[model samples]
Target chain A: MRRMAAIIGCGAVQVGKYPDRLESELALDAVRMALLDAGIEKGQAEGIFTTPDLRGGIGLQANLLCEYLRITPKSMAEMTCGAVAAGLTVKTAVNEIMLGQIDVAVCYGAERECSIEWFKHFGSALFEPVALQPYASYGIIWAYAMSARRYMHETGAKEEHFAMAAVRNRRNARHSPVAAFKAPIAIEDVLESRNLCSPIKLLDSSASLDGAAAVVVASAEFARRVCPKPVYIMGWGQYHDNSCIIPTDRCDKSISSFVATREAAAAAFRVAGINPEDVDVAEVYAPFSPHELIIPEDIGWFEKGEMVKAIETGETEIGGKIPVNTDGGLLSRGHPWAVTPFYQTINVVRQLRGEAGENQVPDARIGLVHCEGGMMNNVFVLILGSE
Target chain B: MSKVDFAWPASRHTPSGREFWAGLKKRKLLANKCQLCGEMFFPPRLCCPACLGDRLEWFELSGKGTLYSWTEVFFAGPEFKTPFLLGLVDLAEGVGRIASRIAGAEAGELKIGMPVRFTFVDAGEDFTIYCVTPDTG
Candidate 1:
């Protein structure tokens, strides 16, 4: 049988505006913390992986980070697929462990988007397929806004319904120490915020922040030996549609619901041999509020247009049915692009280990994380379990 | 709308997208028709990224379509103006959808399925772009 991999440890540098810190320094801090948690020395890791920061496209990133972290590794790479790359980096490490190529692998992402002026150019440039660049300069919000508009059309959901997503996340953020925006916000706050795109307001968007996050993975045998609470890499699914055109099919790959999310979640649940009902908690990387509503429907947590009702009924809140984004998600917890998934993974790990503090789900056994890249074209769904 | 006030830095072209841009000068909406699968591509491409069949020919669109969805972008970075109306237009030929400026429409007036017609807008940097306007017909 092929060897199994487990997440031995994970760490995060509190996400916020760190103007003076270099991206590498932030990443190094998280890596150090993770190594300390895993009880593995820097020299023990045989491989290193990092997610790409395309907005700034840091030069020689993986190489420079390796040099700064002072680690010698047999293999290394900068995985590039936008935000989703965060989870893919860990999956790569998992593969290396399963193949017996490496005993331990470290994956991390660090970028000082808030500390730098390039923050203005962040989401806009990463989207827009090369084919569509000449057409118009559109950003992530506009791409998802098209989908949001269609969702509104189909579900008759008003702007207020969308705003609830941000409000709910902000409430959840109050309990998370790493969360950036913890102030209580009402739906009116989101509605009153300036429209970046018609359906997407500034308050509905993820904050620009500088930080880093990291995770360490090792073989099941190594994890069982040292780590007290290793979260097993249960199963994962990734779907890359990479379509720049507006989705034409109403039933599949449409503007309202993301078919890619459904397929990815389906594949993950299938591989894990678990159902949506079995998933105790979820952490989804949705940069915008509408995405939060659409994702749960696509993931089969609720039926179409049911997220709005779930919001009214407290179905997504902590102590609710699904308890999504217990760490407040990208909407409230600052999102550092490639590292968002790392934070999500760490939060899931915390939940499974019964260490999530106030945001913890009772007796949580399974957690699901969802991340998407480039206008929801590429997606990754990871299922991590604690046995 | 004799002089379109909106400005794009310059008309940029990809080698595969040259025909569609060239068609803008002739007031024609061009798409690529795949020879193998008979599928149409807009914002035209050399090969079908959707379907792998590469033998494609330039096909002109009717410049008539219905609005799929759209947004008024209020915050595009520098080099662009505020609050531009962009639309996803589904060609009346039932082939595909393309994103373009929806000219001469206010935010409060647009409907999802409203008819629109393609037109040329002089972006004033010696650049002309194909855009769509609400079709009263």
Candidate 2:
């Protein structure tokens, strides 16, 4: 029988510009908070998983974080899978604990992209050197914009649908004290915002900020002994398509539908033994507004070309059928790249714990967290339940 | 705030990719075809991504394809001009889609599934780049 793992505690620093602090400082603050929340001492963490500071190009990030926290971990690793890295780190910690490799593990990520000098240039560092770069200036926004255009063309989802997503997330952010953009925005505000790319206005994109988020995973025995309430990791899944550039090789048929997300969600649901309707809340990783519309359908929350109607009918808002991104997703919470997904997982934990003060969903028993990395190349899905 | 200065040196290419770049200088688009699976690949690869076969042949592309998707990028890197149209074109030969700059047309006029043809442009210092334009003819 496989040992089960659960999230015992979570923490995060405010998501905004922190130019005065280094990436390590932000990570240290979040880690300390997480330890406090778990009611466990820093010395209790036997394993450490850290997200690589790509924006800062810092070497030996895992070691540096361990040294700063005074954590003499038995095992450590640095994950570098872009936005989904944090989710992957959590999964790694869970596996380590389940295998009896460690009793408790701390997974944390931090980013100072707002303070980094080459923030814009860091976008294309992952593309194929000679081929992809020469054709078009490869950047995350350009790739997502192309996907958005195709999604709109296929689903009859106008730019307004994307605007509705922006407006919805910003509205949710109003209740989130840690969200970067809290002011409520209208559809007109999103539409009138300067165009970063056609069909993807400036408002449709998430802001790049400095932030850090951390989570503590414990073995079932450890949780039972110390933690009063633990959110069990009912199921987890990860998938990768390995396509570096956008308009993936499967673009002919699967442009709007992300195969990785579907496969990952399927695996997770099977392990959780729960259907899509059983999920009470979701915190999906959608850095762009169009993605917020498409990810729900890809993850089996909605049917083909039906997300527009769901959004229009207010089924995805707080108190709706499937309140998504209640803690102001990346759209309003500010995307700090690798560190952002931890915020998503943390939100799910809070919802399950009934600790979400203002953004709490009524009686949210089961919650789902989804994240994508590298032009939708990698996807991680986790299902958590209050048992 | 003090400005941070950085420079990225030219990229190094593998043997297969070197040939692909050499073909571009002569205005030819090249792809790799797997001998075992017969699958094609763009941005030329040494091994077949599908079958993991090492025996691959260099195949010149027809330079004609259909627009799979497109975007008008108003912001981009320093090397690229602002407000440019970038497209993902599905090669007619069934190799794969490639990202290319769309020229000789307005961004608004471009449509999905429109036929397009590849053209080569010189980027100075012996660097050649590929672009696509609507096959209006």
Candidate 3:
């Protein structure tokens, strides 16, 4: 495959609770691990990119990370495009490398979201100030939960049908060392779980964890020398809607399926010069079960409302026609806020490299990794491949 | 950025919503109307999102609409009581939508597109909050 840029290395700390560890420390650890994986020293990282630290509440985190690493790079940026920031950070490096402005760039994120009450006020603030009390918007889950109802109303999907995706994602987490919840959950368990919102059970939501992940992207010329099996940045596309979670447009544009994801997926596939069937594996960011169903459908791998059958028939598991979230998605794998994209990218890269031991999809030459921010309002889709 | 600082009730209050907050206190539902484009929207904004027009007016709303969607939230911040219902509504005026707590009916009874009316209540001893209820009348 032709290279837009190439991923030389990716490293992630086991995503779980680290009540005592500062986010920067975990960030440095992940960066160092990635440098080691790429067989490059800190000096080789000519660029640094990161997302704003939500847990630490610090601005310009990438600058702080550069200070922590004690390396001055020619290019450095902090991409804060909400939940998709980590992926966009890496994509920024990919673009930088492709532009020949830098030979190597290290993009990373670290989040300690085990506490600090991740969502509420942040969700409200997304809707501007007046929404704080008047809207009662609260956390992002309410929006997704509400969307689930409209999704069922449109697709004839039952709550049980949606819970099955959670069951599948958890089942894949058993072999994943970085995953927080490796214990496989039954469909009944998901159905009986405590409801955070209607049809979205506790198991369907991500386990808030504290961890960090980093990816090193290098120019194709630089990667060919140091890294033997590089995951090439085949193509990527990004699109977003102003309707963060609860849309002013209602189901006409906001809910039934993610319009942004569909458009972004189309753009990504067009750039990759590959169709949905060509993707052997995927790591889609689905913090909730309905998102899991909506993503594959939006990606055009399955028809709308057809993800339920794909999950039940084992068509979406590892070794299936377009295996998804092989390392367990956010549902069971754990989500350390911004670090999630790095973890997902690492999983996709590893699957392409045949380094994903038990979760490996057989001969995964092409892969797709999708990231979402702000209730699927901001979407970024990347299609990667291995030569 | 506090109630003491801004004299607003919400822990995180919007500074541009003085008239909207005051109107709520007087039990009048208000939405931002773009003076130029004449577009009305909920949760008032300083600049109109439609026309980017700074000249805006506080238009009183009838508070009657249809339920667009909703949920039963069991987990949220410390301030939110568990298992409260939130509803997304489409205004009868056809201007915009609102997301707020739903009242006056059971969760099972609420359906999409059902006629709903807004009701203001004084809560937390600070300011007024609103709820969307089934408009049986």
Candidate 4:
């Protein structure tokens, strides 16, 4: 008797800074293809959610997109939570559909990070735009460096432990066409790369590239009639942790991510009436490799400090007991902030339907997707299944 | 002192940094406080999102505050030069504040938890802003 939500169609456009100034074109094109993929008419969607492109002006982006596409939604919202915003949008739309607010919903994101000129154009707004001009990029680097430093101090995890994750993810990326950095890397390579921030090198971070992704979500009855293969949203959770960036009286060892993920996992499992063991695949947002350790431990996949052992033993790989980030993850797949999480959900939807060709898990009936945003600002987890 | 030049957008809300500069004239920092939730909004908000509080109270904050966390930037912005320190200052009224360029220090002497006061500098082109050491420090 549980209501099901399904992603009927998905599309991605890789403009790749080719024309140097075609973000609007790329965004509009992605929207068209997504509607086509879902087999839904362009004008039928009732809700539209967008993740703001760093290149576009704040309020202008959403309305501009609506105008360009020539499709208007009864309700529209812009998601600013960076990478996880897309999946979160889907969750929001699904809730609204269940609540009888809308029928079909569209979520998408686009950016041109490869062009330095575009960044400088927008860099004028910041009062202090030197050294670390885009302050948000520093969040990932700092989070990793700080976490790695603390892990090293407490659990004896070396730089190599973190480096190995990059190697594995890059290896996974080799199989993916849209991945930003498919080229394999070594421990020495990571150590030698230019430091964006201390303890996090160039190789540890995802590339800032131009691309777009979109998905369509609808209610159970609508999905059953309109779509051939509908993946049920078995469980989902989102959490916000507003705390001091630097731990003052709070425990530094315990991050806001743990607090958020634990709550999300509990809610998701309750909704699905399942446990951790029931999950077959996991796609988590790890822009930095060190998070490969912290997230799994937080979700109880492994004991504290055991993620390194899990990675080293190949237990978290494609053929492992529980494959993770089979879609190359944000580190390899390129983190577009808003688009990345939907990519995670799309990967799950494909795997559940047995449509994932080379990287698919054979009998993955249940899949888990996790996205952490805004310096651990929010944690959103979704559990999907075929039944 | 040597001369410096900077570029900025002419915005009506605070056309060319005038919004922040004008507040310092009365020795007051203007912020939008959410009337419903009782939380102060920094950089001024059009509305309070938590409670859908449309009406915001524009109030002047007392310039007194305690230095939270800060870092000295060796590299500077176009409007700002090197040796500027950015700090998250907690006001006496229990709200967090973000400001740039702790002036009157030689970069090497910056410390966390140091007491500081706010100040303004007219860059002549637009408006240059900074925080300087307080008499209490």
Classify candidate 2 by CAPRI docking class: acceptable
Residue-wise C-alpha lDDT for candidate 1, range B1-137, written one tens digit per residue: 45565454434455666666667768887777889888766556667756877899997878999888899888775756778888877888876677777778898999998999988866566656777899998
In model 4 chain B, the worst 10-residue window by lDDT is B1-10
Using lDDT as the yardstick, the better of models 1 and 3 is: 3
Location of the lowest summed lDDT over 10 successive residues in candidate 3 chain B: B1-10
Regions of model 2 farther than 4 Å from truth:
A1-3, A55-59, A114-119, A122-125, A247-253, B1-15, B35-37
Clashes of 3: 0
Q: Which candidate achieves the best lDDT against the true structure?
A: 2
TM-score of chain A of each: 0.92, 0.95, 0.95, 0.87
lDDT of 4 by residue, A130-171 (tens): 111122222224434544555554556776777777777777
Model 1 ranges with Cα > 4 A deviation: A1-3, A53-59, A114-135, A245-252, B5-11, B35-37, B50-55
Which pairs of residues clash in candidate 2, taking residues 3 or more apart in a chain or in different chains? none
Considering the two chains of model 1, state its CAPRI-style docking category.
acceptable
User: Model 1: per-residue lDDT, tens digit, A276-336?
Assistant: 9899999987888888888999889999998878877889888889988988889899887
Q: lDDT (CA) for every model shown?
A: 0.80, 0.82, 0.81, 0.65
Predicted candidate 3 versus true structure: per-residue lDDT over A1-387, tens digit per residue: 258679999888998888788888899899999999999989889999987776556577777787787889999987787788887887888777777799999999888853337565566654563264544645778888988888887787888877888888888899987888887788899999988889788887887778799999998889898989989988888899777666763335658688889988998999889888999999999888888888899989999888867767888888676899988899888887777888999999999899999888888899898998877878999888997
Whichever of 3 and 4 has more TM-score, that candidate is: 3
Q: Which ten residues in a row have the lowest lDDT in candidate 4 chain A?
A: A129-138
Please give the TM-score for the first chain of candidate 1: 0.92
